[model samples]
Target: MTKTFETYSNIQSQNIRFRNRFGIEVAGDLYLPVGYETQKNPAIVVSGPFGAVKEQVSGLYAQEFAKNGFVALAFDPSFTGESGGAVRNVAEPVMFTEDYSAAVDYFGTLPYVDRERIGAQAICGLSGMALTAAGADTRIKAVATTSMYDMSKSMYLGYRNGYTDEQRAKLREHVSQQRWVDVDNGASETGHYSSGYHELGFNADGCIVTGESLFPEKLPEDADPVSKAFFDYYCTPRGYHERSINSTAAWTATTPMSFYEFPLCHNIKDISPRPVLFVTGENAHSRYHSEEAYEAANEPKELLIVPNADHVDLYDQKDKIPFDKLVAFFTENLK
Candidate 1:
């Protein structure tokens, strides 16, 4: 069970649970305006910076939405956080996409939610997942994304478009071998989260692996921009949550196996007529992703870049989230 996190004073939230299509129970914190008494309210289901639980930035966004007169829900993806999973901290691209539609189903059933006015948003890795979900689920009448990364591209190609075809091939080979090893070891073995930077080592095969750092403890000022921004949020009191994957633990070793041939974002054009908003920091490392998605999407789409900001800045940086624009976009389209 998720303890309800604090948010805006005028926002009220409740911890709730619902079953996904697979009959797995998913946990969420649903937020509503303090005096909300209307029936059939516009709603949006929100999630992710990938590997994140509902307790972090997603909760902040959900509460913000509630304060602006929308029913908002933030949930843990399957196999993570308080959500049900046989093996914890695993990432399933397909199942994650399903979670959005499941959320829409839950919203439609609620008496105070406007079933036809439902929308969805994703932050970070879920950016691409929201695109896929909105394209496939018409119930999602509008779509929004912030500092988005296509999980598939990040998996095979690596961050910032690093990693060549040859490198990706080598990575795939290693992941497959790791998969077999896990199966041989009863498939109950878990892997640690991405070992942090400044830590360096190598495996028996000579492939570089992360190890504890011999350098003095890293300060946010000395770290790279992306790492610094994220660390300040996830590693400090600003945004840290015990259940967050990025904040504390690593994912299962075989989690990467799910993204081998994944190619999402091709169907983004299908979400036309319905308004779409793509928000990214002007300097976000993942900005190209939103640019490509914006070009692929139809006229109803708008891309808004936060000036002087980076990917992680939008995670919880109130000054950078553009709540006015978000409220306007959803209000106009979800009508």
Candidate 2:
């Protein structure tokens, strides 16, 4: 028999839409904790893990936070999941930052939410996006990230390792050509870029065989291990959801074209005074991202690691997640 878990409590959830500054309506699920007696409670806006939908990790995080007494929202970024956008699977770095800011706007207007105590959390690639937003807007009282990705750096440097300038230039050219094709054809192709390590039947190797290979110099000492875990997360039912862009074959080719040029941490140091927390697995492939961002950020910043865990492990492994720590972090800071 399969084990069943009650994912949510007496939580009341609603589907709502909020428009960004660009007038794009973004879809989200707002979870109101039970016993809400018209009292103003701290609100948290949660998103990310890159191509993932709200139904996946973000929703889980929202539900958990709601149960813990915060008004939490899990939203789909513009152009992904149930959010509004013309081209599917497209990622705009600037628009993504705006998405978080828009969520703050929505939260601020809610009667039951303590507008001044609003907090934000982002996972995977959106982590950097949240930081960028917090740096610009003081509305976000506190910010936290999990399995974070410095998207701009990742685009240029490849993965946990690093990439060469020549290789990055080549990738930019390829994506640029693909974007032109999309414009000419009036539609972009949908599919995965590679079979990943799991699909290719290499459980241990974790190498992506079907997609464009990484530059030889970008491979890290632990690249194989991290790749294996990522393959398991994106390929297996454990973390896979049909609405997730990662579950699908490919993303809009133009996404990389824009991502390569976006600079996420240009003013990162400005997020100080307000606390910033970076959480990643000790054994995660992407822990270095948190370390780097923590170093670049000023004081009132902290980096927390979940020992013996991988990147995907932080996605939904309830037992391993430090819920109490998170609650305490937000509570103290958002106050």
Query: Evaluated with lDDT, which candidate comes out highest?
Result: 1
Error of 1 at 112 (Å): 0.8
- Candidate 1 global lDDT: 0.79
Residue-level lDDT tens digits of model 2 in 187-268: 5354322211111111234321324221222335666675656656665667666677776554554566566677897778
Q: Which candidate has the highest TM-score of all?
A: 1
Model 2 misplacement above 4 A: 1-6, 188-224
Which runs of model 1 end up more than 4 angstroms from their true locations?
A: 1-6, 188-222
* Tens digit per residue, CA lDDT, model 1, 1-335: 24334556667888999988998899998999765675668998999988888988788889888988899999999988999977777788888988999999999778889888988989998878889988888889999999988877777766666776767767777776775666666655543332222112245775745332212235645566766777777767777677877777666665666776667776788888788999999999889888888999997999999999899888887888898888898888889
What is the lDDT, from 0 to 100, of the residue 303 in candidate 1? Answer: 93
Against the correct fold, how does model 1 do in TM-score?
A: 0.89
TM-score of each model, in listed order: 0.89, 0.87
